[model samples]
Target: MLKTSTTNVVPEKKVEAKQRQGFRLNANDKYYASIFLGPSLLVLTLFVFYPMLKTLYISLFLTNTLGNTTVFTGLDNYVKLISSPDFLSSMSVTLLYVVAVTVLTVSVGLLLANLASQKLPGIGIFRTLYSVTMGVSVAVAAIFWLFIFNPSTGFFALMSGWLNLPVVNWLTSPTNAMWAVIITTVWMNLGFTFLILLGAIQSVPSTLYEAADVEGASSRYQFFKITIPMISPTLFFVSTITIIGAFKSFGLIDLITKGGPTNATNMLVYRIYKDAFYSGNYAKSSTEAIILTVIIAFFTLIQFKFLEKKVNY
Candidate 1:
């Protein structure tokens, strides 16, 4: 009985020591994690969170040209924006632009990705060409397209002449300018979206395709069933980012259209810019910024809630 009791006591002490040692190791791990994450958290606080909060605060006040608050306006800026015809027009145009750009960019990107994923001769060169635009700067792209959209001295003009098509004014016309901007945006965004989807497609297991082939599945069947299901997560990610990018687009509108001949391409971001810098209405601009942020957040939440469920992984 004495020997059995001692054995039990020794085992209990050993277990206790182990538990204490594990606790100390966990605490040390947490300390190191905090140290590693501290700089990133600090940077996010300073650059992202602080500016967002500042923008929200400034949106509640009427400010002068220098962004100095002159009066507390509460929600007047938002209310005014909601009722203004110009603001409403801008909102409609922005929504249309976002939809057009997102859809076209994603569709074209998926098509290009599918082509690039094919095992053919010189396929590597084609893939490189497809993704080359990812390295192009937005300013350079806008300028290049600006010349391309020029009525007489541009690529489109030359094409129209050769095809004997109508000499449509690409930039000067209100309807055409919006489409022009949308096309340019779609082209500019295609490379990144294509690259992402291409990688996702390539990452799909060859075994799955072989199985489908052995099962007598057609190419279309394999693509729709095996390929799409496998790459759905990448598709969802690309779509979400593309929507957000379209919403925040300003450079193309600024450089190519400058909000266009009749405010046709005046997206929310450009509207905010005009209100803040061009018109010196800081309150309105800040309000627009907050509204844009909310709009983006709302769409992203919708995608996560509905679209994310469709993703295979």
Candidate 2:
């Protein structure tokens, strides 16, 4: 009996091993997987990771016009960037621009989203109108806004003449140029924000609103308590994207102000571009680029940590 039991168990173990072998990836499976994933990996390495690593490497040495490292400065490039008054001013302006754009874009987007979510006549038309700007490219939008902000032929100019009001230099004045950028950016970004928040708002169960209505909750109270909390995840996403976009704003500044009126509109990205391409200071530009990357990463991490706690999901 013992001999029979042992023989039976060996056969069962062999069968189980065969079953497990069937689940393992065969040669064909791995070949197909590689075929699908290889190109994407190659592209990412070539474009993203390689450039980042190269930038980090270049930040350590002063390079000549031909992109050859002439002197090993180590962290001296970073030190100088931090100490330079122009760099410091660019950082300050970048901070202000990021904050202004992020807040305005996200808030206005949520507002428009709330309005679009409402059940009303021609709401789809309104939604389409709001989202139309999303189809416009950044460069196109910047140029279009440039036409609008033109002191001679733009909307403001025409309005000022019609109303007999003083014509303000939208793109020229140091104090008002940043606002001009903000306004154009807000309009361009509103469509995306609206669509995202609108989807989030719509996903919220109407039963929650019904319950609130049964409890005599006011509209403002429902908005603050129900709408805000329920859509906090989408809000966080829009805010993060907006912040990053604001930091990397180049085409708008280039077309609208070109960091003019005494560098009032010069953000970090524009400054980096100017340093690298125009001024031929690759090391300094690389340092500034790395610094900007760190700043963006820090802010993103902070958002995920602090803002995430409030998110319902």
Candidate 3:
């Protein structure tokens, strides 16, 4: 019936043009699709892309603090950072923190994820409790760790007494403040990695495990050789996020130490904040900001260029 109607009314040119315009959404369809997707694209453009471009532009200028003038400095900001001891020191601390956070978070998260993936009794409760850390705010988590590490009157003293270890000033001392930051960051961030890894572990095919059993492959070997490789993508994703987050770690430092003890834990992000907001040195802050952006950009590009490689399932 439709074929007869089309043969009756349609011209050859009209039919040919309709064929050329195949697969496009009609107006109503486009309207609904836009309703679904428009908001998200708007948000991405406004919050992510807009600020990124602005930051890149601001990074090119030299600002005067008192007079409130921004002059074009070109790459002079980056040049100063390369020659500055303070910037280099902060970068070193940031690098160490990123390494520590990634390793500890991934390790602890994988261990908990493996345990929680089991069919053991009361596993659901344990997994939920383990994941609660992910819900805690960064400042809240750092404050919680402070209470846990109070040398004179906290859990560390009680634990130290039980284990006969020395009570340490976990926050006040330069030696332990950075370590405390790393430990707390690890504890708080591990839940995200755990959730990702839990899914990966559960997704491993039962048939593979059965085949491993038939071949007499030990559980340890099967996990190391098969499960680890199968879950490597999740691990890689979490590692990348962890590194980026650790590099931009200002909240913990601000809430916990404020980069205290004579700049013992002055990370790049903290230095940028201090220079911009606290010290009123907008020019230097812009320089530091540019450096931070470059570091983030470099790592993200590396992830995309090489480390972002996908595994065939």
Candidate 4:
């Protein structure tokens, strides 16, 4: 009886072990995973992946005024853009704008985040006030700044007249108009950067500060060595997205400068718009759009490769 029982148990154990060695998920897990991932996959395929592939296809064709394919042009559109003066100038302008916005936004946000992180009375109110711009849409913010920067009737006009100072045109001159757009973009993005860094700063362990205090570390020293390093991860994220946002900016440039005063503020996105609608060159526009996408992807890869290495976590 004992021998028969052992034989039966050993066979059952071997069968169970073999089943476990095979790679399989229970039916419930597969069902739940499908339920959770189905909509996102469908949406991405329909909206993002499909459109991107279609744009690549369209870029290879010559199109009529109605954007229908007229002929197969291959890479002629891309080669044409490479030699075009407007495209080259717009690429330069885009690089400048992206660099300016990313640097200034991150710097100011880090400064304000430190201020807001302090445990002072009514600090929450101050944080709320600073973050108010985050609630504003780009169109609304552009229009709001338009009112303030209007040379004849805006805030500068009102104040300059009162003080008898010569009024400076904020949005008309070529040099000033570029800076004006940059200022608006930075201000509009400040609230988002500040809030993200604020949370990162707050999450830092209190014991670290206490230890620094006991070691006679100065506030500046602690900030540079401890605070910055601990919050580097958030800084990396904010800087990356800020660069992308600056690259893709269109509405503010459209409303404020329209790439105007001799194309001083014209960036790649506005160039794409002009080619697509104003010039009625769908093939050229699609080619430019693909190039812009590649530029963005390249920079994003660089950031992840080099910049992300500095992040603490």
Candidate 5:
């Protein structure tokens, strides 16, 4: 009996030691994780979170040209913005711009991705060409499109001449200016969206396609039934980012339109910029910034709540 008890005691001691070692290892892992993540956390706190909170706090006050708070305005800025015709117009334009850009970008990207996914001769070249814009900087893209949108000496002008159509003002006309900006934005965003969708498309199991082929599914049928469902998650992800990006679009507008042609392309972001930097109304701009942030966050939440349900894995 004593010998048996000694054997059991030895095993118990070994088990306890192993557990203690595991606990120590886990604790070390957590310590190392915190050490590695500390810098990133600090950076985010300093830059992103801190700025966001500061912007929110600043939005409640009236500020001077130097961005120093001069008076406690409470919700006056918000009230003024809500009642302002320019602000309302900017909001409407922004919503329209966001929807148009997001839709067109995703649609064109999905189409390009599908075309690039085809197994054919010299497909790699086409894929590379399609995704090349991903490397193009916004400034470069804006410059490239600026030349193209030049009313008298642009691509559209040349095309109009050839087609015997009257020269359509690409950037000068209020109606056409918004479309021109939208086109430029769609072109700029297409590459990233295409690459993401292409990766998602290629990652779909070949065996599933084979099974669909065996079942005598038509190409169209298979595309809608198999390919779309398989890549729905990527589509959702792409759409969400595209919407957010479209809402935050400012550089292209600044470079190309400067919210021009009678404030036709005056998106909320550009409005915020104009208010803050150009007009030097920091409080109003901060209010606009907070509103824009809320709009983005709200749309993102809506997408996650409704659209995420449609995502497959």
Candidate 6:
């Protein structure tokens, strides 16, 4: 009886050992996965997440110019930003640019994408040429446009006979500067809009077009009833990206206009830069920065809440 009981216990002990070893292997695998994932996640948290949270952290305080100490004041900075005329003006200009850029980019992109979707001759070449703008950096594009639209020493000067108009200062003039910024932004940003829309157009089902053809539906009618509905998600995404970009626009403004002519073209980002570096008001700069963040957050939330649901249609 003693010998039989010992033999039975040996098998049970072996089973327990095997189960413990299997659990150890699983834990080791999980530990390795975490180790491999650590670098990228740490970088993202430090560079991206940390800075964003830091901005919110700084927005509640006043930095002493002489003492270099930060003083907390709750929402006082926000209140000051709201009442300031410069802030109001900058906000208005920023909004205008965002709206105008979104409209122009989305409309032109959809039009180009629809045209390019057809089996037209030389489309491959045209698409490549049109997408060249995407490769051009914003600073370079702005400089190129400045040269192209130059009144006295540019391409416009050489082709003076085409239109009977005065040679205007493109960058210095407040009215023309704003318009110039818009034009440059549209040209540079159109490629992205086109690329996104093209992808969306391709994702649309061929069966729908075939069905429309079988029913003898006109091309215009099919596009309106089918293509538009299918590609709305793409449009919304591109619009949101474009608007956010317009708000964060500083390279072109800095390179092209320098926020001159009584700060006519000085949008919010420009104002923030100026306040921080040029005007030597770090506290106000932080306040303006937070205002910008809030504006973008509000708009983005609105878009996700309302427009996101309509994407499937």
Best by TM-score: 2
Residue-level lDDT tens digits of model 4 in 152-271:
999878999999999888887988889889999999999999999999999999999999999999999999999999998788889888988899999999999999879999988898
List, residue by residue over 1-313, the lDDT tens digit for candidate 5. 5345546567788677668878999999999999999999999999999999999989999887899988898998899999999899989998899899999999999999999998999999999999988988779999998888888888879888999999988888988999988998899899999999999999999999899999999988888998899998789889989999999999999998899989999999898889888999889899999998998898799787766576552
lDDT of 3 by residue, 1-313 (tens): 5445567555985687566555354666788989999999999999988967766676677766652537888888788877888778777878888898899999999999988988889999988988888899987997788888888878987899899998888888986888989998998897788898999999999788889999999989988988898888778878888888898898889888889766878898889888878887876776677778888888788677655356322
Can you write out model 2's per-residue Cα lDDT over 42-118, one digit (the tens) per residue? 99999999999999999999899877788898999999989999889889988898898989898888888888898
- For all candidates in order, the CA lDDT equals 0.90, 0.88, 0.82, 0.89, 0.90, 0.82
Return the TM-score for each candidate structure.
0.83, 0.87, 0.82, 0.84, 0.84, 0.83
Candidate 1 local lDDT, 1-313, one digit each (tens): 5445546567788677668878999999999989999999999999999989999999999898899888988998899989999999999999899888888998899999988999999999999999988988779998899888899999899889999998889999998999999998888899899999999999999999999899999999998999999998788789889999899998889999999898988889998999899998888999999999998998799777766576543
Better of 4 and 6 by TM-score: 4
So what's the TM-score on candidate 2? 0.87
lDDT of 6 by residue, 1-313 (tens): 5345546567778667667877899999989988999999999999978967776666688876532428898888889889989778878877887888889989998888888888688888877776778898987997799898777787765577467666677777787888888889999998878988988998899999999999999999998999999887777788888888899999998988887667878998998888878777777887788878887897688678766577553
Determine the backbone clash count of candidate 4: 0
Tell me the lDDT of candidate 3.
0.82
Residue 113 CA displacement from its true place in model 2, Å:
1.2
What are the RMSD figures for all models against the true structure?
4.8, 4.2, 4.1, 4.4, 4.9, 5.1
Candidate 3 clashes between residue pairs 3 or more apart in a chain or in different chains: none
Question: Which regions in candidate 4 have their CA more than 4 angstroms from the true location?
Answer: 1-40, 299-313
The residue-level lDDT of candidate 6 at 104 comes to 93
- Please tell me which model should have the higher lDDT, number 3 or number 4: 4
For candidate 1, the 10 contiguous residues with the lowest summed lDDT are 1-10
Better of 1 and 6 by lDDT: 1
